[model samples]
Target: MEDVKDYEIKALKKQIFISNLKAWIIGIILVAEIIFIGSFFSKMGTFGEESLSENKVAVVRYNQEVTEEFTTTIMERMDEIKEDETYKSVLFIMGSPGGSPTASEELSEYLKAFQKEMPITMYVDSIAASGGYYIASSIKPLIANKNAIVGSIGVIMPHYNFGQLAKTVGS
Candidate 1:
């Protein structure tokens, strides 16, 4: 009976030890996760603050689609420009074939508003067609090379019909 009681006590001690170990491990993981997340957020905040502080000339290049994020970035940049007195003007170096109509319109309106506050100039390096031209035209003195493809002044919906090819393949 004495030996049995001792064994039972030993088992209970082992069980308690395992439980405490698990608790310790879980607590360590939780603390690590919190630290990692805190550091990540701190780095992101620093990056955002630095980007806002740096001198920036908004360049909408290539087939860069103008989405809400793009608009927000532009707005933020405009605010940054306004806040900095040393930054004289905003130059939009546009090099795009254009994107969503609504996005383009929003960007154009925002640029117009910025222009009202400060001098806004657009230098079209390459083809600023369709919606790209739309935004550029809104600017006061639109500068573009003579050979540059300037105006597609229209919208095009490109589609491909593979019906014939599919029929030939037995789909």
Candidate 2:
């Protein structure tokens, strides 16, 4: 009888321990998921004080090389701000080595047109060369990081020699 009682108590304790372990593991996973989701949204400007407000400054981050995708995203954001009718100014956050003069010019034209009604600012951090600078030209309020490289304003006619690269890589 004494031995059986002891065995039952040990079994119960083992079960409790296993359950607690599982609960802790699940808790940790849930916390991890929450953190991941929060950071992801935060980076995408989906939360915080960055939300659009009437007459508030709108910011568009243009960090990649100037391309059609960059132009499209800028245009979309600009359109969003235009529809809102309250954002007083648009800030172009620029850091690009620049590419595609045609793309840059199209974006430049859009910014110039938008500026007729809403003010635009250019904040150049790190670098804004070539096409990047071209787009920033129309924005009246230009701010730059002291150490930023601001020029290389010109066109690049691309002609690639991919034969060597293709031979090196089995693509």
> What global local distance difference test value does model 2 have?
0.85
Residue 3, candidate 2: how far off, in angstroms? 24
Q: Candidate 2's residue-wise lDDT over 1-171, tens digit each? A: 999999999999999999999999999999999999987776555776443344578878999999998689889989998887657878889998899888999998998898898888889988899999888766878899999999878655699999999989968
User: Candidate 1's residue-wise lDDT over 1-171, tens digit each?
Assistant: 999999999999999999999999999999999988877766555433324324444443434544666667767877887777656677777776776788779888988888888787888887788777887888988899777777786777799999999999979
Model 1 segments more than 4 A misplaced: 1-63, 157-171
lDDT of each: 0.75, 0.85
Per-model TM values vs. the true structure: 0.53, 0.61
Top candidate, metric TM-score:
2
Kindly give the stretch of ten consecutive residues in candidate 2 with the minimal lDDT sum: 47-56
Worst 10 residues of 1 by lDDT: 46-55
Under the 3 Å rule for N, CA and C atoms, how many clashes does model 1 have? 0
